[model samples]
Target: MTIRMQPDYRLSIAQIVPRTEAEGPGVRFALWFQGCPLRCPGCCNPEMLPFEGGTPMALGEIVRQMGQGLESHGIEGITLLGGEPLAHAPGAAALARAAREIGLSVMVFTGYTLEEARQMPDTAVAELLAHTDILVDGPYVREQPDSTRRWIGSTNQRVHFLSERYRADDPCWRQPNTLEIRLREGELAVNGFPARSAVGLWRRPPWRTPRDP
Candidate 1:
């Protein structure tokens, strides 16, 4: 019998939406990494910016969950959102590779431009970029809120279709942005772009507050 080895890499994640249509193309598994070095003003995920808090999960476990999502929800892809995915590039690369191995597409949202990402000193960042099919890059400028592009936060950010899996003129990208709300594991969680007037209307109960891993 062949001996099997478990994946040992772990990632610190602020949130995990197993299946979401608003995160990227089609229903996708969206992961928000816990820490970010860049302090972009008016960041959407302010809670996720600190390096201390998150759920530390093994690569194997995350892969298992991805498989479950694929089987249950038929997710077409995986999207890596942040607290800066490049800050956790090694784990992100590993996850991207795993997703690709299982025939899933990969999308990434990053504060760094394509040029900056290419110049990063870490090879893992490069690896993650290689696995990415679409990358939405540049910092979120609150002043330049993009009302036209679905899923993009600001007008300064650029969308790069690194691979041929998607197209700029795709009708999917032209659709209006939407918010997804779900009662997950007894906690009410919301994802996607929210209307400005409704931004602070709801808050998670105390049990769902951000905590250290």
Candidate 2:
């Protein structure tokens, strides 16, 4: 008897920012994968914590949108920020591979430290790392803060360059430097904290919109 395995599709998404000045270097297209196990206090996107919160999208559709973002608006690369992307490792890996194939530099944001990720047994996590150029790893510790870090919150967390020093056999990437987190109004409002960066965001009404407003 043969066992047929289903291909891993793209995981559910909380949001997509097609053109964002923040997240990474250059204009980046960011995908916020849904579902997280870590129930960190004051998490910016607490809405993304529940596994069942968001709608699942097809991998091809995501890739297509990314291509459009690159061609039409000149987005330089893609960034994966998540409610724990490693939770849906297969889907994340598939997406990373797709992005790399198109010559888009990839960056990922995770709650897990580089050491913790190395210890995880999931095969897809390894695959995800294979295509990743940079990883901002570790849990958010609000207590430790440096005024100058870029794209991360605390001093304890590290920005690791995977392609430079990471290996499949041996785990643990080098701790490059501290990261900075710039917050938009929605993030601060949701997280219940003050934010450095402010942006105008549209809030959709809970009720259905009438044909004429």
Best by TM-score: 1
- Model 2: per-residue Cα lDDT over 158-195, one tens digit each: 88878752342332222333222323433321110123
Worst 10 residues of 1 by lDDT: 204-213
Task: Identify the candidate with maximal lDDT.
Answer: 1
Compared with the true structure, the alpha-carbon lDDT of candidate 2 equals 0.65
Residue 157, model 1: lDDT of 94
Cα-based TM-score, every candidate: 0.88, 0.75
Give the clashing residue pairs of candidate 2, or none: 149-180, 150-180, 152-180
Q: What value does the lDDT take at residue 137 in candidate 1?
A: 97
In model 2, state the lDDT of residue 168.
28
- What's model 2's lDDT at 68? 79
lDDT of 1 by residue, 119-194 (tens): 9988888988988999999998888888888888889999999988899999889888878776645666677886
